[model samples]
Target: MFTTIHRWGNSQAVRLPKGILETASLRENDRVEITAEYDRIIIRKATKKHLTIEERFEGYNGDYRCKEADTGGPVGNEEW
Candidate 1:
């Protein structure tokens, strides 16, 4: 398919058809990495790095203390 590049808010944008997006397994608002190689423009889905629990909290002082909150008696049939 042929598409024309148009000016969009000071940026050049090209509209990708739904078929192309579906084939690429991409959805609206999905992040993509665009690169220019020679005379070709490559568009690929961005990969996200999943961090582990320890990696998420690398720097922690552990100075936090939990305090019980006084929530008024339950209004429903719940065991305390």
Candidate 2:
């Protein structure tokens, strides 16, 4: 899709087409995650973050591999 950047209050904003907005299911005031990867920029829905380990494993099942010594422990030290 193509769009021209227009002024929005103080910062400039791009007008997204209805199709694009629908496809992304974005609504006004909704949060969208933005990040730069390699030569491209990516935008997607923002995910909820769990602060405590218990919060992170709230609904986890065998879908995760926990340390044998620590059943509630994360499989790896990687960030969720």
Candidate 3:
């Protein structure tokens, strides 16, 4: 449960254990929010910006028509 902080290029980094990362639900390249609370360092998973249904459909501007054409309006007694 102990690790030594080392310098990575220009910044210092601490290698987290796989168990700790799994417990925290973290993965490689995942973003984290780091903050200093008085004397303690808090590291939390950053909230992902997920697009809603409306937002996903925002780019669509035209009506999507099917390939099949209507069969000349209903002629038989098709029960409205």
Candidate 4:
């Protein structure tokens, strides 16, 4: 679809159509890439950033599972 760039005070802006945004599954404030081709400009969604192990640990509480050791000796051992 063709869109026009209009003047916005000192900078320029483009009014993206709702249908186009919906078809692309884009949300407000989402990251986008603008590529300048020889004749036209291409806008595409940027790849999502993957979280690392350290990043995933941020604000994480210490919740873990542990097995208790057997207090008694061998099960087949004779009692004194």
Please state the error at residue 80 of candidate 1 in Å.
71
What candidate 2 gets wrong by more than 4 Å, as runs, is 49-80
Model 1: weakest 10-residue lDDT segment is 71-80
Kindly give the stretch of ten consecutive residues in candidate 4 with the minimal lDDT sum.
71-80
- The TM-score ranking, best first, is 1, 3, 4, 2
| Model 4, runs deviating above 4 Å | 48-80
User: How well does candidate 3 match the true structure, expressed as C-alpha RMSD?
Assistant: 15.4
Candidate 4, 1-80: lDDT as tens digits: 78889999999999989998999999899888889999977888988676799998998789877889878875665655
Candidate 1 — what's its lDDT?
0.92
Q: How far in Å is the alpha carbon of 22 misplaced in model 4?
A: 0.8
CA lDDT scores, all candidates in order? 0.92, 0.76, 0.88, 0.87
TM-score of each candidate structure, all chains considered together: 0.62, 0.48, 0.57, 0.53
Give residue 9's lDDT in candidate 3 (0 to 100): 100
Best by lDDT: 1
Clashing pairs in 3: none
- Please state every model's RMSD to the true fold in angstroms: 14.9, 11.3, 15.4, 15.1
Tens digit of per-residue lDDT, candidate 2, span 1-80: 66687989999877767788788898777778888899977878778653698877778775756665745745777557
Select the stronger candidate by lDDT from 1 and 3: 1
Candidate 2: global Cα-lDDT?
A: 0.76
